[model samples]
Target: MREFDVQLLTDAVRRMAAQSNQILSPDVYAGLVRARESEDGLTAQSILDDILRNADLAAGKAMPICQDTGMALVFLQVGRDIHFQGDPYEAIQEGVRQAYEENYLRKSIVKDPLRRINTGDNTPAMIYTELIAGNQVKVSFAAKGFGSENMSQLAMLKPADGVEGVKRFILKAAREAGPNACPPIVIGVGIGGNFDKSALLAKQALMRPLDVRNCDPFYAALEDELLEQVNNSGIGPMGLGGRTSALAVSIEVLPTHIAGLPVAVNINCHATRHAEEVL
Candidate 1:
């Protein structure tokens, strides 16, 4: 067995949280640049250029790309043979707390849905964990802003609804979320799971690099089709009207019951902030 200090994990998470807020990942930045270059409308091109400039300034200044630093969502892949000195969950939360406090990132998490009390430190990160074969622990961190998150949707579609139903729902969600969720969005889709699992899968899909495609040929083709349809919606950059409405569409799927097909859509703004580390 391999022993690890919880402090190390804490430190790693803290740095990742702070850095991710400022630096746009290479894949996402490239996607933005591509959008800017290909956008035919001068207004949309200008918007994409401004977005790129904002990202550059944020990284150079070590400041958040957006005011909403977001709720910390941490995904952990722990090795089965590894052991930590302290509670993993608490360690991750401590990291989030330190990142928010020390880095001057905005604290957006609230204590309760109904009471609406601010958590102050952004503690109690939304943590998901899985046990894997290796000895290292991998952390995938994302600061999920609420603007796009609030526009997400999930529906338990009948199996008869099939792929066409999924396509319609995704397009409708994008059309409705136009301007509200921020345009040039990244669409993460989850299909073929139960209600909650589908949502989780959708959120997880956002963690994938924009350039990567689903391994399954059918899903990969579906992703291409969805991207084309969404970009053709004329939502444009910031929904001002153009061909660059969406940067990418990613889908993740799992097996489900014979009678039901559940689908979830998670939308992310242009500043899709996420980072990863292995320790």
Candidate 2:
């Protein structure tokens, strides 16, 4: 087994937190450019252009794309062939706590739900772990802001809802989210899984490259169909009204119980801040 240093994980998370706040991935930038060209309405085109400009400024200045730096959400896949020398969660939390304080990232998380006191540091990140085959650790950081996270939803539909049901639920969720989750969103649809799996998959879906396609042709077609329908809603950029309601729609599926279909929809705004590392 390979022995890995916990400090390596801590340092990686720190740098990733800084980088993710400033850089908009190339895939996301290209999607906006392509959308701007195809946008029929002048207002929509202008909105896309402004977004691109903002992205450039943010990166050039090395500033966060949005004021809400977001609560750190880290996903880890640890290989069974490797051994962590210390408590993995403590290492990650320490890294996040330091990153928030040192980087001047917003401390948006609250310790008490009812009292609503600031946590001072964005500690206690929502961490998820999985055991995989290799000797490496893969970590993905998603700074999920409250506006979009609050808009996430889950539904336990009758098995008969099938694909059509999923389409309808997604459309409704996006429609209700109108302008709140930040328009021109990247929609993550998780289907056929249990409630928790569906939610996890929905969050995981956001990690995909903005322009990549599902390896399965069937899922690819579904994504295309969903994208077309979502854009047709005319939610536009910032919800002002246009053909660019959503930048992309991704669907992740898993086998489910025969009795029910659980679908979760997670939305991330134009500032889809995420970064990944392998150690």
Candidate 3:
């Protein structure tokens, strides 16, 4: 088996945590550029322009893109043939703690759900690990701001509800999110998994590059169709009204039991900050 040091994971996560907050990933930036060009309304076009300027300013100034620097998320895809030398989970958390403290990003995490006490350092990152083949490990990090996060929703639909029901629910979500999600949003959708996994899949979908489509042709079409419908909702940039309510809609799906169909929607604002590293 190949052995890897946990420190590598720590350092990668730390760098991504800080970098993602300050810069928009290339795919996301490209999507915004395209959105700005496609918008016909002057209000929507101007809003998209401002959004692009903000991204540029954030990177040039070496500052966080949005005031809500977001909760740190670390996703690990580890190979079955590899082993970690130290505490990988703890290392990930430490990476988040150090990045937030050193970079002066907002520490929004709470130690307790009910009591809501500040964690102070943003420790206990939301980490997800998946084991696959090969000897390499992939680390993906995202700074998930809660403005659009709070607009997300989940539903357990019957198999009988079918695709149309799914489309309706998704469109309704974009409609209701409106300006609240900070329009020109990126939509991540999870379908056909168990309740919790579906939600996790939706969150992970946001990490997919905006330029990439699902490998499955059907789901890829669904993603395209959903993105079009959402933009047609007339939410526009910053919801003032126009043709670009969402930049992209990414759909991630998994096989599911015959009895259940779980769907989740995770909305991300225009910033859509994410980064990835392979080791």
| Evaluation by TM-score, superior candidate among 1 and 3 | 1
Poorest stretch of ten by lDDT in candidate 1: 174-183
Predicted candidate 1 versus true structure: per-residue lDDT over 79-113, tens digit per residue = 99998989988999999999999989998988999
Name the TM-score of candidate 1: 0.98
RMSD of each: 0.8, 1.2, 1.0
User: Could you tell me which residue pairs clash in candidate 1?
Assistant: none
> Which portions of model 3 show Cα errors greater than 4 Å?
none
> Candidate order by TM-score, highest to lowest?
1, 3, 2
Q: After TM-score superposition, what is the CA distance of residue 122 in candidate 2 from its true location, in Å?
A: 1.0
lDDT, candidates in the order shown? 0.93, 0.88, 0.91
Give me candidate 3's TM-score against the actual structure.
0.97
Ranking by lDDT: 1, 3, 2
- The ten-residue window of minimal lDDT in model 2 covers 21-30
Q: How accurate is candidate 3 locally (lDDT)?
A: 0.91
Best by TM-score: 1
How high is each candidate's TM-score?
Answer: 0.98, 0.97, 0.97
lDDT per residue (tens digit) for residues 138-254 in model 2: 999988887888888999999898888988999999998889988789999888779899999998898888888788999999999999999989999889899888988988889
Give residue 176's error in model 1 in angstroms: 1.2
